[model samples]
Target: MSQNDGTGQKPQPGKKAPSGKTLARRQARTLAMQALYSWHMAGQSLNEIEAQFRVDNDFAAVDGAYFHEILHGVPRQKTEIDGAFESLLDRPLEEIDPVELSILRLSTYELKNRIDIPYRVVINEGIELAKVFGATDGHKFVNGVLDKLAPRLRADEVRANKR
Candidate 1:
């Protein structure tokens, strides 16, 4: 029996279902994390890494613009993004797992620059990324760090949410 896809048609062989905006954004973040991890490990140029990722991945259902934004944005603002959360870390930056570090940097960038996204969402996305890509219990670390960084980055939004 053929199953109906969400679009109400029989699933086509070899065809991927298009993602909703949220899922597309999530895919973007996931890909960005991987690209960031590669850049961190290899010390390669961000442009090269981004080009490689674009060629290697299936972006049909991904948010291409958001993916591009993060792949470039995090590195472009690395110093500020890291500074925003580095002091909150219990250990030295070098001690962080590469995956967790990548997630942290990406989410921190959104928190600081993407004011349209709520601080809670930035934190939640970080936690979710950590759960998916990080070591066991890494989600808690992500949660803690983002929770601390949120207020500093989104003072008015965080303040309004608390009230």
Candidate 2:
């Protein structure tokens, strides 16, 4: 029996499936994380490695340029993101799991760069990614950290938007 057809269950509607843009953003983040993971694993130069990822992953065709922008942008802004994180986290950033670290970096970058994105959505997406990619309890850690950090990271904008 097929997965969806045999359970006597109908697919839920109004669940708000991701738009093409959202899906592309998610794909871009996954690709960027994969690239960063590869770099960490192999210790490759940024230009050499990222170029290879572009070719191998067909990154040019992806829709969410913001994801790629943040992937590259975060490294440049690492000190700021880390400082913000350090101020908010209960423990040092170094103590966090590498997967969780990456999620936080990606989400923080978005929170900073994509002002149009709602802060809650950014936090929720980060928590969801943590659930999938992090160790047990990682989602809680992510949610907690983002909850504290989002207000500071987005600051007056969040207050202005009332999100």
Candidate 3:
């Protein structure tokens, strides 16, 4: 499997380490997903929920900006994200489990907004999230849907780069 650098650049063999901030951003994204899923399940405000999580878990160890941007951005663009998913998935987004839904939302946001991140990396990260947090077959489901959506959403870039 190919590994990525901090700027989302796929590295050749024996390349230097990814920046600390990049690894922190990935961690922050994971924490944000967990936080968002928690809020969705509890029906709590983002601020209240995040603040409580911070106090309880000392999540301040992660980058706050990365956490805030992903959590807020995903929900802010949820309608459009779900629309993309609906077009790609065999079923409605509502039918997906909440954990799987969170993974999809995060991956979709990155695929749409963070063009620096490779589509494959975005999908792989989502699959990893599903493996850790979702049902037995959830990673396959997330991978399938995101794979279909990635080419469509990134058609121009893919065509230009020959991915």
Candidate 4:
């Protein structure tokens, strides 16, 4: 039977069904992680890489606006994001796994800039990304890093949640 593709179209029978986590925002995060990882590994210019990603990826099921926001926003804030993660790191920044680093930086951005989003959600999403994209056992590291970061970045929210 056919499944609903992310873009609101029905998938062809026998085609692989999309995962349950096909919500547009989540898709945007997933894509952002990938694009950020690409930028890190390939050292491509953000504008060129973003343009290429837009041209190459199907955006039907993705939140195009959020995807745009993430890819562009993260690099602009790279110094602060890296500094945040670096403070929480047990090893040198360059030693991190690319996928985990991407997720951590994205999570850090959300924690620092998107105060409307709950810290728990940001940490949880980072964990999920690490689980999906990181090396085996990497999710634990992501969780630990962001768990520490959440309090530093969102002190009031973390304090309130503890109550």
| Best model number under TM-score | 1
Candidate 1 regions exceeding 4 Å error are 1-19
Judging by TM-score, tell me the better candidate of 2 and 3.
3
Model 3 TM-score, all chains together: 0.82
What candidate 3 gets wrong by more than 4 Å, as runs, is 1-18, 160-163
Which is superior by lDDT, 1 or 2?
1
Best by lDDT: 1
What lDDT is reached at residue 14 by model 2?
50
Model 1 lDDT tens row, 24-126: 7878888999999998999999889888988999889788899889988998999999999999999999999999999999999899889987788778878
Whole-model lDDT values for every prediction: 0.87, 0.73, 0.81, 0.86
Q: Is 1 or 2 the stronger prediction by TM-score?
A: 1
As a whole number from 0 to 100, the lDDT of residue 80 in candidate 4 is 88
lDDT of 3 by residue, 13-38 (tens): 67675567656776777788898798
Ranking by TM-score: 1, 4, 3, 2
Instruction: Point out the higher-scoring one by lDDT: 2 or 4.
Output: 4
| lDDT head-to-head 2 vs 3, winner | 3
**Between 2 and 4, whose TM-score is larger?**
4
lDDT of 1: 0.87
TM-scores of the candidates are 0.86, 0.79, 0.82, 0.84
